[model samples]
Target: MSTCGGEGPEEREREWEDAAEAVAYDSSTWPPPVVAVCGPGNSGKSAFSRLLLNTLLGRYKKVAYLDTDVGQPEFTPPGFVSLHVLEEQTKDLTMLYLRPPKRCFFFGDVGAHKNPKLLLSYIFGLYDYFLQELYCFNETDDPKKSAIPLVINTSGWVKGIGLHVLSEILRYVSPSIVIRLRTTSEGKNLPDGAFWLDVREGDSRVNIIEIRASQNSPRHLLVKKEARMIRDLRLVAYFRQCLPRDFSVFSYDDLVQGFAAIEPFQLPLSKIQVIDLHCQISDDAQHDFLAGTIVGLGSSKCVSLSTECPFPWCIGLGFIKAVNIPGNFILLITPASRRLLANVDIIFRSCIVAPTCLLQLQVSDEVDDITDRLRDL
Candidate 1:
């Protein structure tokens, strides 16, 4: 079906109303804003996602970027959503593609926007989950109801229906940040609430920079010059759920040791090593690995993508060509994948893989210290 407006005006209005009525949380009790970014493919959702984290990290120690694009997840570990205090993101250093310091979580949703059946399913599933957990309409353990600042990177398949859906999504998305690409013609007219500084392809550099200059709030924002770096070896943990049925390769000793320290989605030790990729880094590998790899929560059978997955059990993801073992160059299996390719040179960039620990921010007293540090910036 074409992604265009459909049905009668009355029906359309009714559907919109139904959608609006569905999310009826009290304003005072509603969770923090969940920001989602949607634009045509190649509009640069990935790089901009980092911009969101980089800007917020100045204010927050921990932040999360969730990739709901499904087909093309941007924030995997390693080269993909690589946010480790690898280097400082400052005014002097900020460029088109600069590495960021600080540990922010990146998760990519497998069945994101392009897949309507899957997308709608998850949406309804989330709604049901929200009702069960928050509304208590049923007895269930649904965590989507939990309040967290969620940033959804959407898919780009332009059409009226997609735009309509995009608009509807915006209604639900109380964005603390939003980045949109203006065309060469409208580049000069880029409006408020959009974070992208770079103008569109057809846009002249003059207007683009002007639009960016308007967003000069980052000047006062604290930029960490020397940030701590972490590399999470636990990224292998995502393989359990994302990988396929009969595919795995792992060291018995390493598996045992890794699981001892951090469990890989409770994978049965017996089922380990089914998906073998020959190359295995030592457990005590020098740095945090999360920066350059995908980490999923429920799965532990991924091939390690260049970014991070949201669930923590990644099950599957892809990595750069250099990281792949011989023979299976363009590999895909457990820790299976969505093949969104990037330029090769960016792979060598530093990664942050250390596991993150959440400090309670709801408590004002303790959080005051962190806030004070930020205000000074």
Candidate 2:
């Protein structure tokens, strides 16, 4: 592989143009403008979102970015709807690194269609926190006081129930600017008018901006490589922080070696309750079910087994590296802060699963042997 140099002049020019568009629509009102980027898959929604965030940083002290796309998240790992505050510009959005979000809720599933109602509740809760706590106006009399601008990035799924979920999110957010991207295919675009207007009749308060994708737009090729592969790489990149920042772990083989050699933290099963977010299974099966599974570490005071209770706040993601059923302990590997671990009261087993390729181990043997199973733990 060849090492690339700095950004070319053409790339700089296009970024400037995209930033100018965002600057033009910035509301002159007292509060910072709220912007939402929506479009179908590979339509440059993430591209446009990064551009807008860069522009907003020039105007506001900090920009609040709410990522609703769990499959291909911008700032954090997959299976989370998170809010992040950006104080500096992001030169490259493609590079996956570890950064703690200001607030996050684990959806577990990649697509919202699995549980739309629960997804909406998480989005609303984040918005409420932004409004009640992070709002810049009315809370302070200092000159530096100002509401932080918001930028929302939606998922690529834009048809059927996915479209409805987007509409519900728009209704709840009521953003000041809606940047909708369209591709060459007309059928893939959203409805002609505002899809969320039905929620509030005769309310066209939201500003709509239509953007057409260029030939050079970034696209994810799911056929050549499965989307799950990218997700696994992301998880590896995040957990690789278990190693020193100076040491590099680039490939799947390196990750497997690193994970296998590292010592895992043992959590007492009696102190924390384990609940499957998607379904209820027999107690006998929970042990094997949780082994090698990605789980959400929750810190809320109320950890209910029933689904009626709202999903608790997820502090971070953890993988059950090993389950010692008879010993009444589980070994977990996570990047969560040590302070957050003290408050963790329950572990929610999410639908998110790490790919097998990242878990496969390489065994050194001089003699020929036949084995179908690869040892992961």
Clash count list over all predictions? 73, 2
> Per-residue lDDT tens digits of candidate 1, residues 64-86?
44444434444333322222221
Off by over 4 Å in 1: 1-33, 77-114, 123-148, 174-177, 185-314, 317-377
Expressed as tens digits, the lDDT of each residue in 1-377 for candidate 2 is 11112255465446445544554444564467788888888777877788788777777778888999988888777999888888898877565555688888888888887778888888888877777557657756764445788889998889998898899889889887787766657887788667877754875877676656533344547522656777877887777767667766677677677776655666777677777766657766877777778888997763433343386778888877666555566677787877778788788878877766434523222001111121222
- What would the TM-scores of all predictions be? 0.33, 0.84
CA shift at 221, candidate 2, in angstroms?
6.4
lDDT of 2 at 339: 78
Off by over 4 Å in 2: 1-20, 23-29, 141-145, 214-226, 250-252, 301-309, 361-377
| Best prediction by lDDT | 2
Cα deviation of 290, candidate 2, in Å? 0.5
lDDT of each: 0.33, 0.72
Error of 1 at 250 (Å): 22
